[model samples]
Target: MLSQPETSEALSGGSTGRALVIHPVSKTPPGRVSNQVASRSTGARLDEAVGLARAIRLDVIRAEVASVSRPRPSSFLGSGTVENFAELISEYEIGLAIIDAALSPVQQRNLERRWQAKVIDRTGLILEIFGERARTHEGRLQVELAALTYQRSRLVRSWTHLERQRGGFGFLGGPGESQLEIDRRLIGERIARLKRDLDATRRTRALHRKARRRVPYPVVALVGYTNAGKSTLFNQLTRSSVTAGDMLFATLDPTMRRLGLPSGRQVILSDTVGFISDLPTHLVAAFRATLEEVTEADIIVHVRDAHHPDSEAQRSDVLNVLADLGLDQPTEDGLIEAMNKIDLLDPTTRLGIAQQRLRNSQNVALSAVTGEGCDGLIEMIDRRLESASRVVRLDVPLTDGKTLAWIYQRGEVLGRRDDNEAAHISARLPEEDIARLRHRQRLH
Candidate 1:
């Protein structure tokens, strides 16, 4: 058992708050190297659990490592450990107990009875955080759907008294008799309605995406670990004041702005919600519609906080998520790494790493807070876009002025000449749109 000091303050409405964290550790035999590795990994996970609890301002009163018992069925600490935890709860007056693992509804209910407090599993805590952080309608809806799905699984706990309720209606009866059943049915209907609403929203978003594609501006999406300075870099690049806080999940909505690159080419820059280690699978599934922005982007900018101790691990985590989304394939040649927060490092170290990364032709390094190396980043983007584009030289007859005007509007024309019979035009367009333009020219 490990105890950390608790601050004396009101948790909510002057109610004292204290929480206990329970982590189950496997007691595998010492000879196996695999078990050793597993134990080491479990220790690291416990540390992260503590850090997360502290980040959320939870008053952690005690942390315990209980040896696993009945692993096949219970997958949690043994009965003796539960008894000891119950004793600790009585002694410390804990209002909540956070189990750093997924729990079945029966396990959750049993634990709550033993501790006489609200029991929250790792998934529940993350859902609560997301619910609090969601700022946009789509974000809130996604979170709500995920929460409802998770809640549906725990409906067993919710209707524990079903066996005791003698019914006159065979589980679906009289007007007011089956109140619990009615409530459950109503909830099921609501969940169905929400799913329909979300489907409609997805369609609307698809139409909006089509409209953006018609504008023909390349989109650059910023992606990285939470608190990796994505929103900060977005603000620095676009000069728009979006919420850039040090807290996790600060930017829930995808924000887009037109950014003028170094070559004077305008592109759309999108700042999306950040990724995290062990992000809930349900949350990922729920947010896939919004995260498709990354897949649609012409360039994916991976921003990283160079100052954090676990920056490398954070990078790996972000890459794992990207790989899961199929955005880490070698075919995705549009990935750019942006190592941010160089200003927080010592000047010599910052310059050395920046120079090294630049030399390796990996990506750009910049400090979003101080506007350092931002010009180089923009220049790199412009260069990549220019390289991927194709230049077309077309001589359209002056009789078709509309074609020339459309060309000027759709692409960057480097030169235009008027001849007695035709208008000679040299312009650059994205490779994908070149064929369309060629067909339109043939029609003219």
Candidate 2:
């Protein structure tokens, strides 16, 4: 919830101090929107919540899992549970309470009023983290847009104390607008401006993508769950010093670098923001400009933390995000799974993973930390990109040196023969390069 008082402090701009992380495990039946996540233990979820707290440099004084058989409308937690945590908050001098679930705006207000402390839910916590981690102008813009959108929904939490209507404007009607209406109108205007700026940014990105298409470099995008060693693998493959830490969302902005594959093909490798379970829709929409890079990619590499117990579940989450991005056919589009963190696995499990990779042409087990099997991943990438290319025969006039040079520069020559009037060449080229060649021929 967003408010001018301590509630605002919790959701938007909380200070770093003693914090209590709580995960409410729901016993609700399947197919309902509950706090329970599949393929992960309650302890693991609580631990992840704690990690999220620490990512923002918060000193986590206590971490606990509260079981909720039934949710209370006011506080989301039962009275007994809320009272118990209130005591715990006081005992630990907790300044903030982090709830690892989505809370209604009313529920958030009620909780804060009861505990007498700042309370933040999962969405707010994630927004806060993104707000702090954003560095680029576009990133800052997107974060602010998302934050404002989120705040707009919870305006009821603010100005509740100012129920009395202020005097009307001079020469205006008798009734005056409420503070909530004023804040809503202001937020709506800001959101409109943000949309305009983001639209321009989106256009600029489309132009950049168009320019890259002209260069005809195949783009390979890396995607996976948060803290799944994507940045580590990016650094290992590109040798660029991106911040690769053992924390969620270490890389927020999209990063790209030129990578030379084993087949001597130069491809643009993009490292994108990692996906998480139950990611906020506001965030997904805000980062659409950044995610368009993935949709336009020539190939996608799904990096996975193979050692994590929830690795499979993490894969599902990433795939779901990709599907939401209109990439429902990721596997059919030739997805490559790079099973990272093999170094952490025991010898027997690692050997099994290696064997499995041999059976599955799309899987590659590797350790980015130790540079193990990374070459194999690169080789796999080369093969996947190679498979995406087509062999085409072109007849170039002897005097058309420009066309001949363009083909040779952008494609691999398979077979060539020179005649008196023209050169008949067979070459493998990417679809984009092929289209360009055809367009040039049509113009001639």
Q: Which one is best on lDDT?
A: 2
Error of 1 at 30 (Å): 3.5
What's the C-alpha lDDT at position 380 in model 2? 83
User: Which candidate leads the pack in TM-score?
Assistant: 2
TM-score of 1: 0.78
Which residue pairs show backbone clashes in model 2? none
The C-alpha RMSD of each candidate to the native structure, in angstroms, is 8.2, 7.6
- Show model 1 residue runs off by greater than 4 Å: 1-17, 22-47, 54-57, 62-72, 156-184, 328-332, 346-352, 355-359, 396-425, 435-444
Cα error, residue 424 of model 1, in Å, equals 5.0
- Candidate 1 — what's its lDDT? 0.71
| Residue-wise C-alpha lDDT for candidate 2, range 20-126, written one tens digit per residue | 99999877777777644568878778888898888877799899999898778889999999999999987777768889999888898788778777788888788
| Cα lDDT of model 1 by residue, 358-399, tens digit | 576657889999999888888878888887787788888899
Error of 2 at 141 (Å): 1.0
- Cα shift from native, residue 259, model 1 (Å): 1.4
TM-scores for all candidates?
A: 0.78, 0.84
